[model samples]
Target: MKYQDQLKRTLEFENTPTRIVSLVPSQTELLVDLGLESLIVGVTKFCIHPASLRKNKTVVGGTKQVHFDKIKNLNPDIILCNKEENTKEMILELEKIAPVHLSDIYNLDDALKLIDLYGKLFSVEKKSEALVSSLENKYKDFRHYIKDQEKLKVAYFIWKNPWMVAANTTFIDAMLRLNSFDNYFGNLERYPEVDLNTIKEDLDVILLSSEPYPFKSADIKELRSRFLRTKVVLVDGEFFSWYGSRLDYAFAYFKTLHQDLSD
Candidate 1:
């Protein structure tokens, strides 16, 4: 079978991949949900969903760094990765071991496309189609609920120390738009760093994500002190960023969050 990755690279395989290794955390969970749990021989340390996966499989490494020896031992027929989560160097190295399918998702359409492709690749077309339908329906419902709500100018903070935010040309920004939040940093490049003070004047709400940097309530208090007029809320990073199976619940989370912001 011949398949092309999101990077526009074409790859072929002799047969259906039985042994698989997934480097991206969200994709790992998607594989399990697609009923490829037993076939998934290896996953990164960050593939925390199905929590049992960690206890069962060998941890190859993180998103950017991988243990080549561990993956080689797994003898995977196919390896899964994401353009943003895994580095070019890592994907190149993994290609030598097995055919790699890289998913690049920027919006809901791209995400649905990836899920559909995964179904075809794994021969679980029915399941993937069903999941996508469910997500589409939920998203429609959420949009209807917020149809009358005013769009809020939001600043979604993803990292600290450098003080970076989810800007334009990124999945997080796409998710923010779906929730009817106008990303204040949307005009800028992806994940740009900026002084918080410079953006405070335009932001109606400041969202602190709970991953990569793990912003807590304390962090919200700190930001609230600085931006007294803005509404500060701690958001689940997975809901806003993870573009795989986790998206199944993201709209539901967004509904609750929308209500919170409205209040």
Candidate 2:
């Protein structure tokens, strides 16, 4: 069968891929949810969704770098990746071992497209359709729920040392928008470092993410001290950034967040 990746690269497979290597953590979890876990021969160190997934599978490395030798040894029939998660240099090298299927997701539509593609690619059309239908229903309901909710101006902090934020043109920003949270730095592109001295204090909320930097209670306290008027909270980074099966629970989480803010 002939298939095209999000990057517009064409790939062909004579039979359903029995051996798969997923480099993106979210994509790995999505593959598992699509009933492709048994076929996953390798995954990156960050693919800790099932928690026990990496125990049996070969750890091919991280998002930016990979162990080419280990992946070549596993002999994956296909390598799954994401444009934002994996680097171009790494993708070029991964292609030499196996056909690479790439996904570029920025919003709900892009994520659903990837899910639908996986369903068709792996011949799990029913499962994919069911998942997509469920997600669409939840998304519609969530949108309705937020229609009347106050749009709180929020700044999502992803890193600490450099003080970086989600900014615009990112999956995190899309998730924040879904929650009806207005990004204070919407004018900026991608994740950009900001000067703490110049940060506005009139913001409604300051969110510290729990991944890539692991913001904890201490960080929230510190931020709260600095931004006395704004509500400072720690949020699950996966829900805001990881776009896939995890999204099945993200809307629910967003509802809780909305309720908390309202209270």
Candidate 3:
């Protein structure tokens, strides 16, 4: 059977899935939240959430590449994938072995929809609904706190080697907007490599994420020197990047982040 969500097309199992493989780290964490820890047979090397699971689960492969032999051995009933994270070729090959659920996330609403879909797929509706409700309350609190504040003009950097910034129509941008921060690159396309000189004018903040590039404290210091007036912050990449269960922590992080910026 097929189940469709706002983010992706999920293939339903005859019953609850017994053996599952997650290609995306965030989804792996979500699976754990849904009480599928013991049922998840395989996960990518990057599926480090619930950190103990990392030590216990089988490391199938990375997002771009999967160990066909390892996956075949695990005999997963269903495979979870993300459009932006996994390559097309990888998805095609995985489909030949097991049913593949492809999730395409562009914003917060899509994330929430996927959570609900997962609940239905795994027969964990109550758990998923409760989590979503908690997240909604947190988001409401954040809005209430920032309602009267000035929207700070900020640039969220995701990658560094080529200097790419999160642009419009992306999850990160949506999160930034939710926190009442104006994305400086909102006019650009997704994850564009922008010239620093282009964004040197009137920028309020430069956010450096902890992953994809792993921006360290030193990097923040360097950025501070370059953009003397703009505040440079080392943002938690997971809080901003992961669209799954990690969102529970993201709202509180955003609240603290906004307060830090104001101070």
lDDT of each candidate versus the true structure: 0.90, 0.92, 0.87
Off by over 4 Å in 2: none
Ranking by TM-score: 2, 1, 3
Candidate 1, superposed: residue stretches over 4 Å from native: none
Candidate 2 Cα deviation (angstroms), residue 213: 0.6
TM-score of 1: 0.98
Instruction: Encode model 1's per-residue lDDT on 1-263: one tens digit a residue.
Output: 98787878887878778999999999999989888898999999999999899999989999999999999999999999999999999989998998899999999999999899989888899999999999999988888988888899999998889898999999999999988889998899898888976865767999999988989888989998988889999989999899989999998888889888889
Model 2, 4-66: lDDT tens digits are: 888788999999889999999999999999999999999999999999999989998998989
What ordering of candidates by lDDT runs from best to worst? Answer: 2, 1, 3
- Better by TM-score, candidate 3 or 1: 1
lDDT of 1: 0.90
lDDT by residue (tens digit), candidate 3, 35-85: 879989999899988888868999988999989989999898888899899
